[model samples]
Target: MSLPHTPLERVTSIKRKLIILIGVAVGATIAVFYVGVKLGAWPGIAGALGGVVALAAVWFLARGLTRPVREMAHAANLITRGDFDVRVSAESRRDEIGALARAFNRMAVELGETDRLRRDLVANVSHELRTPITALQVHLENLVDGVESADPETLQTMLDQTIRLGRLVEQLLDLSRLEAGVVPLDIRSFDVETMLQGAVRESRLVRPGGAIAVRVDPTGLQGVGDAERLHQVIANLVENALRYSPTQSAVEVRATKTHEAVVLEVLDEGPGIAPGDAERVFERFYRSDAARSSEMGGAGLGLAIARWVVDLHGGSIRAEARDPQGCRIVVELPTAIGAA
Candidate 1:
């Protein structure tokens, strides 16, 4: 219904400004020729009309050529203003600007994702802190009001909550130091099965009567890293598996040595990660579909720390959907030099 404007004209870009400027100049020249034609200069008027048509073509070409750059600048401004959702399409272009535009879009997506994760972190942390603090507060209040007898069991429950809060804070601090590169790794060659068994022991100690198992292949495999830290990684994963799994279900840890690396897996019979959520499980404060109540869910720092530990050892870690039902988290670490 309306033919006055083109898509290029709708956007405020450098190219659009050039089109307007050139159009104004060409329009003025055409106006002068039209006056000459009114004075009986028909030949000049015809030449002026041809020039006007040429200028319009130039404007259209300019718009087409500079549109991606305009989109790039616009997207940059939006990102600087804390908006990361804007994107520029550069898929078909083969120019340098096209590559830059594609890079810009990638940055925007990563930033948007980071922002969303930050929001979730705040929310989850608030909930985690509130749960333990509220419990402690209630226990103290009961004592103050003399509403309940100050039994040893009540005292012990309050103390346990206090310890849990302290542990969460400590884990947060540890993660921060790790990310800041303040925590150094003590790499050493040792049997990784020791770490695996330690983690299983920890899981059973914390959850008595829980089904936990470990299987190591080909006698054993030597792993190189901070055995203590690797121990922490295995424990974190095993604990998480135990947390999500049904009480009587078995949680298994398996380690197999390949030619160049050793692969470790933690398998649980919990509701598996939904499609596409496998990688995100390593993100801080990110809980899968498994019910992460205050009593069961940790501070959400364990997997994040585990990821860092694996990365430091030149390893890769990921979660996969298990067969039938549940999730399997796998970690692969390079074998230590000269390690058996």
Candidate 2:
């Protein structure tokens, strides 16, 4: 008996394959025995010939069942050696081996993505840390060598760089804690309008001339969750808006209540995010404009932190393009009853 090397056999169900294998082996044995006996060969010789014929039939008929398993073993070895690009031919088989191959492909994709993110994180962190450190070092060197005097202006510039470095480090730590779930939420019901107002006031204090505004529809709306964390989310959004907005343009913070959730929005009169980057902007260390953000002392973690906080509170956040030119970020949090 001969096995046909065709894809149809691979797509056939394993049960059918097994049935065919047993049928072929038994039929081949009987045929060989009958031919040997009709040719006047000894009974023992005929039986031995029948056994050899049966073994050959079984081996040929079973290759399809074992080929995929062999391929998977080889692929697994490659994966262990850090070769995520290796893949087995699933051949569209409707069997367990096919399913396993598909799942293995998915896992390889995920592992490759995770490795890429890890590498990006390391590189971005190093770059972020170096910028401020280099600036501070240059300033200190100038002062020590008498290249520049330790006047109030020079000292203030040095202090600003130091503060930026400290802020970046603190944000990194906060993000780490949030991702690890080590920071517990202080969940409770609080006034959404008041919180928005406080965030606006704080932004106002930080940039006295920035145009920031807050509005709550059906005023005195309340929300359920960690007040402080929610405040951080709002503050980060407002600050992000202000950073890109034109000096004379307003950054509007709005809150409205719906049947399902409490919706908060921040709108800015700045260049809007491109459609492709709307989602990626929330990724850690991902900046739409790296040079501009660095000049603004942004370590590209504000939106990332805000996303983490919103996620922890069982909320959703997204970026939108404001009409006539600008950007809007929307956050929706579970209401008290919904949260419960």
Candidate 1 lDDT over 96-205, as tens digits, reads 65567768878999999989877877787788889889999998999999986799999999998998899888888888788888888887888878889987887677
Candidate 2 residue-wise lDDT, 1-340, digit = tens? 2223643365447777777777878888889999999999998899899989999878866666777778889988998898888777864667776678789888888887888888888899999899889988998999889999999998898888888899889999999999999998988889998899888777676565466778898788889988888888888888778777777888899999889799999999888788888998898987786425457638889889999999988889999998899999999998853344
Estimate candidate 2's RMSD in Å.
3.5
Candidate 1 wrongly placed segments (more than 4 Å): 1-77, 87-99, 210-214, 246-252, 267-280, 288-290, 293-295, 318-328, 336-340
* Residue 295 local lDDT, model 1: 48
TM-scores for every predicted model: 0.67, 0.87
The lDDT of model 1 is: 0.78
Candidate 1 local lDDT, residue 186: 82
Residue pairs clashing, model 2: none
